[model samples]
Target: MVGDSSYGAMSIEELVKFFQTGKVVGFPTDTVYGMGCLLSEDCVAKLRELKKGREKPFAVFVPDVDSAKELVEEFPNYINSLIKKHWPGGLTLIFRAKKGLPPGVVSGEGKIGIRIPDFPPLIEAMKRVGSPVINTSANLPGEVPPVSHKDVRVPLELMLKGDSKGGIPSTVVDVSGERPVIIRMGAVKVFEIEAITGKTILLSEGNVLNILYVCSGNTCRSPIAQYHLSYCARDLPLFIRSCGTLGFSGSPATENAIKVMEEIGVNLTAHRSTPISRELIQWADLILPMEPVHREEVLSLGANPYTILPFYEIIDLEKIPDPIGKDIEFYREVRDLIVKGNRWLEKHLRERFNP
Candidate 1:
């Protein structure tokens, strides 16, 4: 609507032709205006060039439920109920991707976001094209998404006319994992989704807490504690990192530590030691050091007293002694202690975050 009459006046036949030729179009969606082209290697490349430097994976708009079902690897059983209640509205669902989707439409973890929009004109255009199309919000990175046809600034081979609900975007729920996580809350209310799913939706990202675990050599206790809680509380909004007060950076976890963790089903083979620094201390919402001396060391480097706590004190366990250079049996003892402490930590996180 904001463009010159000549450019905005493209017909449906012309729009379909443009899609065939890998050109993008702007159209109104139930939530907002969106710009995209039918999915293809060339089309996705062009779309990526248009939104230069943006890294978030694009969502694809399917014409109907059947198209969406074909796009994902396998639908979760609960998804049928959610679709029955919310499809053709403002909900974008993420599922494990079926193979052969172009990289631009698939997340790094190989998931795809698929939405069946309520907007009739867009649906008609997709049906004509006979495939799903990239449906990213019609704006560049860091810019507000256009709510009306006239607000759209991207160049398009055609601009389809329709009324969007405006203001709020669609709620994005990732069903790719064991538990569904709401990555973005938008037009649909959380309680509404909860009511349909009959389960509490964990918020995956907003207001996340950064937890830093510190030990003498990041090789052992801290990494054990970090990885254990990370796997146990994977659904919570917490970012876990570990470092050592006295250990060298980039050092792998000691062989015993890695072997012992594997016995308990936690992987520590890939962990590299990060030496504690002011930046890390400042980044943490909570810093759990292996012993009182490590806490004292961090405090000397200006960590806030409230944010830094000795692991023993919080878990009500005896101080974790350094197991560096110790035998494999000694390392196993240390790993068990960290595992017990991490169970306490995981409970504390769930109670605090209400996930």
Candidate 2:
């Protein structure tokens, strides 16, 4: 039994030791307390034996985005979108399990609940363990979930003492079908979930032109193109957003880039970086990646939202040159490319909207 200040105090080695030995440990999450075991066939059996509970479906908690991608079969666009928007927090997603997950974990339901909690201790422990851990409420079947370590029963108390520092459980979301359905609302609110999945009133409703722009960094090319398209379509009606294939969230645009755009009366100072997400793809009627490789990266996320090289249909260029750290000449070159691209896009939009 490990006893210390908080679950965050326990070393990764200690947590891995307990999980690898097939012991269930109570841990904190973003919402309430949860019991977890390594998702091995033998571990699953041992967890069931230890709990002496009915054979109901259970969820699993992963360490990070990459780990979640490995456990489930081709994640749908909607699910990917949700993960990007709500992961590393309390949102638990339930999906149809592929062959890899043990049948007992899901109780033969062909579905599995999975989450990536925001807690540092749990993330570190999962990283050491190298697999998704079984995640269910710490309490026995049909009982209220334990909100704190003190609320857990003696047996669970023993398990935590032996293996973990008690932590909270994550909020759960079921995405096993068409739309995301909330199973349990915890730390993450219901409206937050709706914000990501809900449909908005279309301005003109003809085809609802959805556009996504992708580049190396969202700061310059993609965002500029995004705004350019939106500006050109001000008289027309279209849904447009810009993002990067590998951009950080909430980061600001580059200084020189902003300076140049300011000269053009484009206030990109308010633009913040956002990475390409599953939701972005789903929301887009057309995906305009800056290069072929970026187009491939977008496709790898999931299907739909026909990805294309932004200038492929207009010209034969295969890649967009990176304008970072370049002089004014380089910026001018990029601006020229953007202008050409937008001109082509304008024609395309006219065809789609006017025709």
- Per-candidate TM-score against the hidden true structure: 0.57, 0.50
Which candidate tops TM-score? 1
| Per-residue alpha-carbon lDDT of candidate 1 for residues 1-355, written as tens digits (9 for 90 to 100) | 2222122325556566767877788777778888889887777787777787567788999889989989888888866788887788899999999899888889989999999887765676678879888878888788898887778777765676654675579989988865668788676655456656766567665757679999887888899889988888999888999998885889998898888989988898889999999989877767999998898889988886757668987657668977889998998888878878888878766754565
The parts of candidate 2 lying over 4 Å away from their true place are 5-9, 107-109, 157-170, 199-355
Assess each prediction's global lDDT (C-alpha) against the native. Answer: 0.80, 0.67
In candidate 2, position 79 carries an lDDT of: 57
Tens-digit lDDT string for candidate 2 (21-58) = 77777765666666778887776675676557547766
RMSD of each: 13.3, 13.6
- Residue 246 of model 1: what lDDT? 84
